[model samples]
Target chain A: MRTTHVGSYPKIPDLPAPGRWRTAAEKLQRGEITREEFRRVEDEVTREAIADQVGAGLDMVTDGQIRWEDPQTYFARRMDGFSIDGLQRWFDTNVYYRQPVAQGRVAWREPVTVEDYRFARSHSPRPVRPVVTGPYTLARLSQNRYYPRFSDFVLDVAQALNRELRALDAESPPLIQVDEPAILQHKEDLALFREAAAALLEGVRAPVALYTYFGDARGVVRVFYELPVEVVGLDFVAGVRNWEVLESEGFPQDRRLGFGVVDARNTRLETVDEVLRALDRVSRFVPLDRVDLGPTAGLEFLPRRAAKAKLVRIAEVKRAALEVTR
Target chain B: MNGLPLFPTTTVGSFPKPPYLLEARRKRLRGQIEPEQLRQLEEQATREWIQRQEELGLDVFVDGEMYRGDMVAYFADEMEGFAIAGLVRSYGNRYYPKPVVVGPVGRRRPITVEWFRFAQSLTGKPVKGMLTGPYTIAEWSFNEYYPTRRELVLELARAIHEEAVDLERAGARFIQIDEPAIHTRPDEDFDLAREAMEIVTDGLSAYTITHVCYGDVPRIYPRMLDLPVHQIDLALKNEDFALLEVFRQHRFTKDIGLGVIDAHSHRVETAEEVLDGIRRSLEVFEPRQVYVSPDCGLKTRTIDETVGKLAAMVEGARRAREELGAG
Candidate 1:
């Protein structure tokens, strides 16, 4: 059995003088602090984030995407041809993401996630998986003013992201995660997603995992299974009906499956037994070794304390499941 | 119905914050500035916004919500039995303290009354007293206090009712209860939404208006007309005038706030585009029953874009008034 976080740990508290990433960003904006100084704090926070995950005894670790303000806008601001405009409420959540407006041809100017991933890889004792917001999601979330057709936009973003993924792939990380939560929203575009995902994962040396959540991906799971990736992550908590899809499709024994047992969207703490029970249900589809346990989505919605506790619960649930197997 | 001007122009509350105001807000948040100092800055910002709207020839105006922060959090913080949670990202770079309903929700004192007084003092034109609607407050908040969602929503409704009545008592003629969250999840129980709106606007002497943005207005229609407000402000420009067909298809008796300018975009709307939107809306609604406004709050926009959009909206409304021969 393996343990890991999907992405985004809660904002690390800057106690004594409390502050969050927004606070730091505000300071940077006001010229009260410099970009170099802001980055120094981010590095400090990122190190603590990795340590928190390590302390929880995760096998496949992620950088927690602590620096990403939110998934879509973070990348939107970095990429060419994407201008982030007003804030749009992120789905039904209280959270929001700056609505990305594609005014021109989407192009990758530089490696957006490589340095952050390298920093995380250097700090972690365990194998680190760098996560990127999937191209399909970027296309879905953005208001495309340039593209005549939506598929053209998705694939264009895919090509742009392909450049970044290839750069990260050069380092040969153990795994790379492409988050496509928007796939559930755009099931009609599955055929297009296949092309986009293939292009995104092409020429990449590392194992690629495509993850989806926020809705049931059961209808789209078969399409995801067909994609060029080593692992498929599903939201078992939110997509409770996903179990039926797994039973019908039957898990590919050779491939990996990420079981999202923890509910990251809500603040409620899932009991260890509850997680163990979900894992038991997951076992029916795939063997324990093939399974990766984590949150249904990023833990950004949770407070720092609750997010940490959930990590501890995941560790505890994994140990309990492992002991039972032994 | 009340003989309001043909193609009346108003804002959907908030205007763009000038850089100095944003800086002042950041300083206030950091505890570098005192509460009085922050209030002075807010007052200054509010005055500037009111003056701008008057200059733009808007028939009605807003204080631009300068004294407020997040719409829900601002009210939640002031109310009893509500606790403010940590800053959660509401959108890219923008954050709001999620309100957690931990106990019985009620108003101990006036929330927006004093702010309305200050804003009304600034402008002879009627300023809308803005409040977050009960359904949105209940929806946006983490509810732990009430037994059911209905109960929680009703409790919030009662609290808002208090604020609305107080605003009326404070000599404000227009009060807008914003319910931006209602249309987001259209599948959810809307009876609770209607019940809550009825409670909030019950017996209000003020011209009751409700603004719902970034949602599918057509999905909630006809039933949405059942909302107890005198006016319904829909983000028509963002919906790309799609809801105009819905309005035409259905019998919409009440006044409609036609959002001719897209508030979400930073682009300055051309007066022609705004005029086109107004003309389309005029086809569906009587000119006297249509209020030309921005699709949503302009807080997210830059000052120049906001000013330009409002100017276009007013100019478009003026053109519509001339075409309708209502002058």
Candidate 2:
């Protein structure tokens, strides 16, 4: 079995005086540093985030999404027909993200995350996966002023992100992951999400991961089979019902599984024995070879040290799973 | 409560700490200063804020929470069964020491009563006794000891209830229990939040207010009215009073701490803009039910911005009262 992270890793490392990145951000805001200077600081931390994931023995890694301000505004600020507004709490967490307001017809101006994806690919020793916030989540979380119908807004965002995906596809990344954690909360919009997902994955040749977190995907798990994606990722920690659903109704055999076993939100460490037991149970339904061990969600909810440690635990679990399969 | 005028103005709770107080807090962390020295500075800062609010012509006052850090962490540091964890990111470029519940949580002493008494002594106006709600304290913290979320939340509610009773005894007429995390899991945990609130304000004599901000307000509305409190304080200005649309559908039964100023913006709102927000709120709520305030706490802003925003809020409320011929 292989291992990978959901998406973000902490930008700041665990250090006694790791105030350089924060100071640089403050300076950029205060007009004390150039935009290029701020980019240099972001690049430095991005390299550190990549190194941490690589050192933890992951099969594939991301840029750690260190450059992202938050999941929504990072892409929203770069796209056309959108403006950043006041802060809103992101789901149930203590963390907040700046709300995005769609002012006009949402369209792709240029490649938003392609440069960051290329940067991660060039810096990492392992193959890097490009992660993007899914269209359904973008539409749900944002304030839509232009589109009278929510489906139009969601599809517009999907088509816009499809252009970005095609740009990243040119880079020939290992895989593309689209996070739609918001779908877990609004299950009635499954048909809308399916349409948006098809639009998002249209021309991309790379294998795509449709991942959901922050809650159970039990309501929308059946629809995952119908979506045009290679892997279906579900959170098993906060959304423990996903496991119950997996037992009652097995996942599709044609699709690979992103086995999210580690608790990403909490700092608690999982033992190898405990993970092996969960892996053993999951192996009954899906083949262990078709699974990728990962955290329940992005590791950004944790501190740098705990996030790194969780990555290491995943690697350890993967090694034990391989031995058990052997 | 009957002595207050219509459109009475107040703040959510905290104000920005002065530069000197911030430095003193840092020094105290590093053991360069004693607890007593830090307490003296905190008292001074609290007094300065009290005087500033009085000068700003606000009808009610807050202690400014000058002695506190993260709302959850401050209480966790004093309560039993909690251990402070390392820094976790709360949002963009902001981090806090998240509390980890290691055992059964309970309060040994009355937290915030001493500060409430001290701030009340300085102000003739009723100083609000600010306490983070039990649901928020449990929600924001990492729980390891409790078998279930409800157990931890209820235990926290009992502990916070004790503090609320102490504040009422300490001559605080307004007790603001902030449950900013209330709407986080509105579908599953909202009823639990209401249940925990019932334990908190069961028989409290003070005019209780619960401040919930910056989430899906539309989902929790009408249902949020069921929360057992005298007032439901909300951050409405940042959302541009979009929540008023929900209130139009269901009549707001309780007094509303109407947020008329955007607390997050660096550009101070014009008095006209704040007056418009108050006017919008008054459309749905009675003039007496409307208590003018900022969207949330002013701690995230600079001192200048905080003062500017609150000043505009007061001016706008004064205009609103005049428009109603209640001044």
Candidate 2 residue lDDT tens string, A25-110: 88988999999999999898989998999999999898989889899999999899999987778878888899999999999998
- Place model 2 in a CAPRI quality band: medium
- CAPRI tier of model 1: acceptable
Worst 10-residue lDDT window, candidate 2 chain B: B84-93
Which residue pairs does candidate 2 place in steric collision? none
True contacts kept of 2: 0.50
Which has the greatest TM-score? 2
Model 1: lDDT of residue B112: 87
Judging by lDDT against the true structure, name the best candidate. 2
Residue A45 accuracy (lDDT) in model 2? 91
The lowest-lDDT stretch of 10 consecutive residues in candidate 1 chain B is B86-95
TM-score of 2: 0.96
Candidate 1's C-alpha lDDT?
A: 0.83
lDDT for B245 in candidate 1 is 82
Query: Model-by-model lDDT, in order?
Result: 0.83, 0.89
Fnat: each model in turn: 0.32, 0.50
